[model samples]
Target: MNIVDIIIKKKNKQELSYDELSFAFNSYLKKNIPDYQMSALLMAITINGMTMKETINLTDVFIKSGEVYKFNKKVCDKHSTGGIGDTVTFIIAPIVAALKIPMAKMSGRGLGYTGGTIDKLESIPGYKVELSKEEFYNQFNKIGLVISSQTDKLVPLDKVIYSLRDITGTTESLPLIASSIMSKKIAAGATYIVIDIKYGTGAFIKTKEEANEFSEMLNKIANHFKRKIRTIITPMDNPLSSCIGNALEVIEAMEVLKGKKSPLKEVSLEVAAHIISMAKDISVKEAKELCEEVLNKKEAYKMFEKWIITQGGDLSKIKVSDKIITLKSSVSGTISSINALNCGKLAVKLGAGRLTKESQIDYGVGIKLLKREGSKVKKGDVLAELYVNDLDIKLTDEDLKLFTIK
Candidate 1:
């Protein structure tokens, strides 16, 4: 019944019962248990890990801590574990929506190198990220898609626990991380969920093996809630899209919706096809062709424009900063690699991203890649450009080393 008992049990590597896990999380939510006690329990969990049952129990309690949205129509949603330049949601949601699939999503802001879906959407002028429940449902009913900010009343305990983990150096615990993400998705009341799990330098999971493990864990947890989930593991050694900033990322997504041929377009279509396949129960090939059809015919673009206007976003005024610096190739050769993690860190340094939740982001500032992998460049050829509010943005030797030419 007491937090101390649970903490001590976990500290001794003993498996806590469902009631024990429930009592700990509920007590923490009710403020009956101090943060110090929770911190101790988290550390114990980090060191001694949790069984699948324990992890699911923790996730259940977290979901029960807040409101679970129920939609009148069949609900489908997509989530990404996050990666540099991840704007796939903008594409997939619209693609599925254009297919008459109900897509209701809740997203968050960027904290480090990973781009937040809400941040990219907010870069559009007049876009309303905070929509009331009625407005959200209305948008879904009207256009079959709606994206909004995560409500505090939904899985609030994840917020508190995540903040604590941020400072306690326990953020790397797989069980904790999986539970935090799955809890929100489960609470969102989506019957079908598509998740993008990225791993590499710029992703949370640094290896494909780790990504697979996390994906399995995530699916198991989702199954506990009886939600059908699909997970994709992608590489993040370089930015997922061609752009790595707020407004710039939106511009890239707009290009994709307009049927422009780019890397972003390619990856987004793949992810969207998966969503379409699940939502419509069609073959992957059929889903892919349909997704491309929507893009080529500009149906998804229309949906995107309508969604933006419905949410109060202005498409016309979205612009990147005028302060741009083009970095040229010092030597001519093929670009063998680009370090996404370094580029993301540089973006954060240049005010394109946030160091913490409280940090303000300059939506106008970001990096754009002019050339990608296997591209041969001549000396003095433009490789990338930097957009910044401050003209004094400095690039370090390490930053310059991010691009490797062979």
Candidate 2:
């Protein structure tokens, strides 16, 4: 019953019952269990891992810790497990909505190297990231799409545990990660969910094997709850888009919505197609064709515009820093690679992302790729441009190492 026994039991690699899991978690939420005690249990769970039953129990505890939203209409939702230049939400939501599917998403903010959907949306002036429940419901009912920040009332337990996990180096635990993500999605009440699992240098899941394992775990949990779920594993060795900052990413998303063809658009369509298939009871191929039709006909873009206006986002006010530092090749060759992890780090250094929770984001600053992998480059050919407002932030040779040519 006590937290010490729970910590010891988990540290011994024993399975915890639902009551034990709930007791420890709820005690922590009530401040009866100190962080150090919780930290011990978390580390134990991370290293020893949790059984499926235990993980499901923990996820249920997380869900019960806060309010669970319900919608009168069936809605589809999408989530990505952190990545560089992963702006699929912007394009995917509108595409689904354009096809008359409802999508209500609760997005997060940038913490380390990855960009957040809410942060990108906020770059558009007057865009409201926090909405009351009534406002969120109204927007979903009106436009069939709404993306906003998670309210404090939803999954508050995950917030506490996630912050602890971040500092304790326990974030990579499969059970913790699955519970944290699934808790939010379940609480948000999406009837159908598509989780885009990214794996590579820029993503949390570093290898394809791990990505597959994680996806299986997700599907297992989804099945337990009887939720319709699809998990798509994608590579994140390079930026998903040519742009890697808040406002710049928003601009790139708009371009994709306007019928621009690129890898970003392809990924968006793939994810949207899955959601559409689930929501409309059609095949993914048919959903993809529908997505292409709406995107090509500018219906998705129009929906995007309408969603923005409904949420008070001003596209005209979206701007990137004009202070550009273009990185060019000193030798001619084909671009063998662009390190996504390094690109994300450089963007964070340029104030495009937050190092800490309290750190302010420089919405106008980011990186724009002029040339991608496999592109031919001559000496002095531009490889990328650093859009920055701070003149003091100078480019370094380390920054140049982001691109490899041979």
Question: Which structure among the candidates has the greatest TM-score?
Answer: 2
lDDT of 1 by residue, 272-359 (tens): 8888888789998999999888888999999999889988999999989999888888998999998898888888888877665467
Per-candidate TM-scores read: 0.92, 0.94
The residue pairs found clashing in candidate 2 are none
* lDDT leader: 2
lDDT of each: 0.84, 0.89
Please give the range of 10 consecutive residues that has the lowest summed lDDT in model 1: 163-172
Deviation from truth (RMSD, Å), model 2? 2.0
* Model 2 / residue 265 / CA error / Å: 0.5
